[model samples]
Target: FYSELLHIIGLVETKVGGKRLIERNSEGQRHSGTILEDTIIHLDSLDKISRLSKAFIYGETHEERLFNVALGLNITWINRILFLKLLEAQLITYHKGDKSYAFLNLNRIREYDDLNRLFFQVLAVKHEIRNDDVKKLFEKVPYLNSSLFEPTEIEHQTLFISNLKDEKTIPALSNTVLKDEQGKKRTGSLSTLAYLFEFLNAYDFSSEGSEAIQEENKTLINASVLGLIFEKINGYKDGSFFTPGMITMYMCRETLRKTVVQKFNDLKGWSCVEFDELYNKIEDKKEANEIVNSIKICDPAVGSGHFLVSALNELIAIKSDLKILQDKDGKLLKFYDVEVENDEMIVTDEEGHLFEYNPK
Candidate 1:
């Protein structure tokens, strides 16, 4: 059996809880120490990598000794440079070993930066890239964008489900779940259709705001958004992957700049503040109640719930502000204008489109 297998099977222990045996030559001519508590042996093969032999050889040693060996600014410089590259990319993480000898996950680092870039590099270099490359690439992507870019939906979902096998996973909640008692198991299914529900309803599915989209082309628009997000989770055909998260976020920010941020900036000065104040002039607005009634957000992938949850949270905030405005203007029929917590779709005036239970 191999050293690792034998060690795992306890046939001949190698590492004793992360420490190995220390052997020496009594007179620089023969083996000195016992292989076990009572057994003694003379060395026959010097280069064999058996568990018994590995028990005598230690893993990489303390950092101080490593540093001592790397001194004179030669080897240490290279190590430091590599370490700094990882640190800059925020790829370095606590490893399994003494502080003097740290272990790092280079694959995870690569996966984090640009999964696509890392995938091609790994594929090109035989499914493994240098640990340094992985770490360096991940540090450049924003955490949110990185979280969203799954190389493939199936593979990514497999990883996610693997990570959360024992945990309760959830997407958006249904009205029944919203009304469920605290600490109770709130059950619901996730569907791709839900992705377009809010977007369609928010703009009334009209052509004025989202002119790039046509009324009759609702399915296409829906498909486009869902398809893009799905591709982000999975990959496009030919095994290509999503753009790096940092670049993706930058693009998103640039494209939606005027619509989200610059528009807020334009509503500047006292007028903006007054607008905000007027917006929140709810007559019976109880601060504690509002806080308690704050909206909830969810992301299906919830690979740390970056994009979907952020969008949901922002929309809720806007909804809250709008609710306050409605209240002051004697339109405070409900605590909020939209009861997202209990959003039940009632087919009104239209036909053919029916509801279905979809678990994504």
Candidate 2:
């Protein structure tokens, strides 16, 4: 799905190339409702191309660099939007399926301008100081103090999502996830904005408590799924190597478990070879949690932080095994079993039901 979207992003965006020009009628409007005609590509003049290359903020290099910039920006927007989808679903679930926080729907965001307002006015700005009109429209929307919501340095110089034409439509991918009314895969062209949102809504993005595999349920995706998606998109441009989930799981398990043991051994004089040994030695849950929390882990080239997420899961599972996994008040969740499976942190009660978090 993202691979197809990347193609469309490149087609519409990028200063070097895109929907460059279209035939205009005598009325000074775009030519439409006309018979089909063969259109030939022309580059009789290099003036437009030269101007585009000159605007490259990274460096005065080949015009092809614009593709890279476009790819980067597209990835940035994709991550931000996907995160918002998760946030939106989580809010609705927390509020017992209230539709007010559902901002990703078609009604709330019909065009790029609406999305632009959401990015800058609604989310980036603080709640109190937001414009009166924006506040009234997005009253239920909380201010998200994230740099992701802010415009990038490249955006200041070049085109953004808002700059894209609402009327513009791109040829749908042959292998599109979109389905027709008859439930067959859709073809032909579609507005990129609608395509994106429709593709997103095709699957169920559940933030519900039940992780049980139901045949009726759509694919379940959490943060780990986003990590994989980001990694896959990274491969879209240069055929970059994607570290597999098996590799990440193994790497985190092998590295973090030993690191935890070493940290505890270093802090205390206990000569334990394995992390599990600390379980018996641990007495005060507070002190053990303190010791565990002191351990730091870092990944120098964390592209999508897949490794980091796996490592975090390992830490949590290790803490739980050591009986040191505590709430903010340092109280142990003794009845809960926390473990990492398939790179996801799963919490189950004594009866093995998925644990649901309800905000207090």
Best by the TM-score measure: 2
lDDT (10s digit) by residue, model 1, range 1-360: 112111111122223444432222223322111111001111112211132222222234432222222121111222222223233222211221123221123333222223234333332243233456644544332232222223443222112111211112123323221222564533543221221122222221112112243433333222123323333322211222333334434443333322333344343322333324534433444542243234343444433223443344334444444453234444533432321211111121123343222323
Residues 72-182 of candidate 2 have per-residue lDDT tens digits of: 556677777887877877887677667887788678888878888888999999889998877877777888888889898756545456655566565666787778999
Taking every candidate in turn, the Cα RMSD to the unseen true structure, in Å, is: 23.5, 7.3
The C-alpha stretches of model 1 lying farther than 4 A from their native spots are 1-115, 118-146, 150-209, 212-219, 223-289, 292-322, 325-360
lDDT of candidate 2 at residue 329, scale 0 to 100: 75
**What is the number of residue pairs that collide in model 1?**
5
Global lDDT for candidate 2? Answer: 0.66
Which candidate has the top score in lDDT?
2
